[model samples]
Target chain A: MIDSIKYKIQICCGTMCYIMGGAELHLLNDHLPSNLKDKVSIEGIPCIGKCDTKEKHHPCVKINGEELNNATSQKIVKQLLTLENNDLL
Target chain B: MTYYNNAVITKHELLVRLIQLLDTNKLLDDIDRIPLEMRPRTNSPIRCCVHKDRAVIKYKLMALLGFNIADEQHELTPLKEYAEQALEGYTQNGNFLTVVDEACSSCVQVNYTVSNLCQGCEGRPCQVNCPKDAIMVLNGKANIDHQKCVNCGICQKACPFHAIAYLPVPCEESCPVKAIRKNADGIEEIDFDKCIHCGKCMTACPFGAISEKSQILNLFNNIKHKKEKTVAMVAPAILSQFKASSAQILNSIKAVGFDEVMEVAEGANMTTDHETNELLERLNSGATFMTTSCCPSYIEFSEKHAPELKPFISDTPSPMAYTAMLAKKRFPEHKAVFIGPCLAKRTEVYQNQNIDYVITTEELGAVFAALKFDLVKTDDSPIVSKVVRPESRGYAASGGVTNAIKTILSSEHNITTELIDGIDKKSIRLLRSLPNKKVTDASFYEVMACDGGCINGPVNVSPLKVSQNKLKKAIQEIQSEEAAV
Candidate 1:
């Protein structure tokens, strides 16, 4: 069996999020470090209801459940870099 | 219960069984979401264009065992290598124009909003209220000058008779943008400049007049050449349509020509994880009320009518978009087509660089018919699995969002979450009527614009009311199974 878990990033694909640029949310796959490309999984979602709170602040996404704001490919890459560094640490 | 052993069941056979179970109630629900008035009575599975915007299609094909497969996008494996193929050999129009005619007669107007303004002024309130001075006195009645009148309904409101009416344009009314208009011939005309390609109007039109230029012939030619593998990502609501378990649905889709079948629901499960984290952070950082941007129509509405709310839209990919990434990751060599009950998905797929094509249930049926292949009668010798995450299955209905959030928060801190679906003025009124402002009470809220969830999408094969009941049954069945397990 193939190990489904590796280096993967999941994104919410809910309609609300897609309109906020969720449709192209996984464009970040291009920005992944070449060494980690095979391990990375960028995905979308329907609705998680996280941003559905009374006070919604977004362009919101998560990497392994760690929240990131002003999410873009570049910002996500940096977060991954820190995770890689922490694994060594 | 028509029970077929999983080991012997082909995906097509499974699908045939499912389709037979889909009666008028289910068909009505599907038609309601798709906004289809008159669909074809094809000998095989039926497919047709849902006239809302830019001619997006809805398809319901007979799958293995008489199951119904409804998809917004078709399998795109055949279209990957258009450069090397002869397009003429494979091109065939299913008398596309004829399908549109049958639909026009039965198309009923869906009143999203009605004219509340009756220009109550004495000097023909429509003329007095006309901002452009476009109204003229013709035969002592208000007549709008075509050149100067901007189609703004101020005159309609000003008229006491409420005689000045905003007649529903068969094709252009459902457009997310004000892109569609009438030409000199009274036929619908699309303005590319303002068109966002949402395809809502394609599903809205009664005449089946608005349609997308065909890329099917090119796709068929590519398949003949065999350039890439086609993978189809089906939406969660579709799972309810199948009489058998989810695994059988996967097998049927595979039988339809998909190399691999994956659930878009997994994306829903993952989104819950991503969005919840985002919510916690945003709340800590100090932001006021936030609205969901998941529904494409709502998002487009905010962009055109409520741009101020853009910042509030949570940045998350739709389940389909998320699943597309997973498919690409798992099978990098394959081109993906999303199959579901949504016309907006056509525009969403076109706009997204990752996805290849979006064919509705109607288009899928057309493709199956074109091949003279009956998915229901196909041999049932395919591998299938029954495993689906509870969260994944829960993503099908309107309140599925709330359930996922609730499950996630069950073990966590005490954050209050409230789910709101079928959001309209009435729902807003209920929220406002609360004693101490209910909107502030919940840590999270899920709102779906449609009265029923996506099962009633503009491209589904079931009715909203029946789908709602089915949704309840499916959910309860799942819950009881979980409890028993």
Candidate 2:
């Protein structure tokens, strides 16, 4: 049986993140591959405070509670697919 | 950052770094390390090599320090020296833009090229339609002769196979007034006399070759030294720039060490009254039509490109001008800073002395990033002014000005308006021809240099659709609150 649990994707919508490209990440749902469309859920949350880190990973995203740095829509989709493929193993 | 291209992200990062250095008081000591730090040996170079990228960054830093690249006296002058000069109150020499020749890609002059897909067909439509006789069929393939080609693009359209491609220099193509062009070295040069400071070319350049001299350091120095009580005159467009509420944004401006915050929408209300009276006077005097005089870029366009329409431009002060005047009256000794989404506003501030400094919404964002001000968590407070009308807040959008005036004049006078949504080559031609046209259908004209208005200004961070929806919601909320009151 395929793992049917939906992966929670939290996108930072803070001012810094919004300006630094988080605005485009909101459209990740439309760009996601058909297979992963039902496998993930996306939510825009207030600043996760990760952008203030020493590395300044702006437009940060959290996928299934794991932090992703400099997250783009494509990067998020790729990460989601990778996660799903690993779950199959 | 994906919303903006790579170049804009780099520019913003550079700004954030510069502001951080300024805040830490390590600007002069560590300024030279920025270029090296940003492009280290480990990182792949964006240009020919790491050294070239460093050179471009150095010149960009010079521009950010409020000096034109032309002001560089020698090759050995370090970035530290420029920082020192900037700290010592080096004012810009009235030029708003500087082109870093090092960053310029030096695009080819030839515009039209025949692709391999060309069939060299029997029809020879390209050769037949060439107005300048610039197309010649050699070796059974159509070729564009650069020497004779006038770039009219007639041949490209006539090609049946779409084999002809028109290559454009983005900056040159985007400029509405033809202010930016390649010089003898093929590097883009801005002609200040022709420049309206609209900043379309700045946004169009993918290489980020064009730099606007920032007054961020100057404003920072003033705030740091406590030279005077600094007052921020926030534009209405700023309401939708971030995900936070309008009240939170204003409160955050206060949290950024601004002693006071004044909404420019208050002045927009003033502008509505004054401009409406001016329009009424013009119509009573048998004037054909009058145009709104709020957009600084449009004003510059009229003075330089469309001189014939000068008589029709209203003489009333802009919202910024009115706000600055009010600030002067309210707090005579306060340093007034106009925070808005405009490059032309810098030039406007320069001409209008009441406004001590001007910074774009992007620069303000950089300041927030440098100070680590989380606007989402900022405390909300009541807006500074209660007199701001719903129509005044609408001034941030394209037809907002006309709509505001229409609300007042529609009852008494039959007012028709023409909105020049954004200034482009096509809109410019229409604006130029307006004076010569005998028939006038519109009584009032609303012209905004940026498409969709100030919310979509070149320096604005948020996307158009997002900002528009947010602005619409904010305006509606304000409308309901006013109705309840």
Chain A TM-scores, all candidates?
0.74, 0.87
Restricted to chain B, the TM-score per model reads 0.59, 0.93
- i-RMS, each model, one decimal: 18.7, 2.2
Q: Using DockQ as the measure, which candidate wins?
A: 2
TM-score list, all predictions: 0.52, 0.90
Q: Which stretches of candidate 2 lie over 4 Å from their true place?
A: A1-9, A26-43, A52-56, A78-89, B1-3, B114-164
DockQ per candidate, 2 decimals? 0.01, 0.41
Q: Model 2, B1-485: lDDT tens per residue? A: 11468788778878888888888888888889989888888888888899999999998888878787678788899988888777666675567888988889997688888999899999999998888888888888998888898988888899999999988898998898999999988899999999999989889999999999888887887687676798899999988787777888999999888898999999999999999999999888888888899999999989888889999899999999999989999988898999999999888888888988888888888788778777878897665777888889899999999989888886758888899999998988878877777767788999999999999988888778778877886688678777888
Q: lDDT of each model, Cα atoms only?
A: 0.50, 0.85
DockQ, structure candidate 1: 0.01
Q: Could you tell me the lDDT of residue B63 within candidate 1?
A: 15
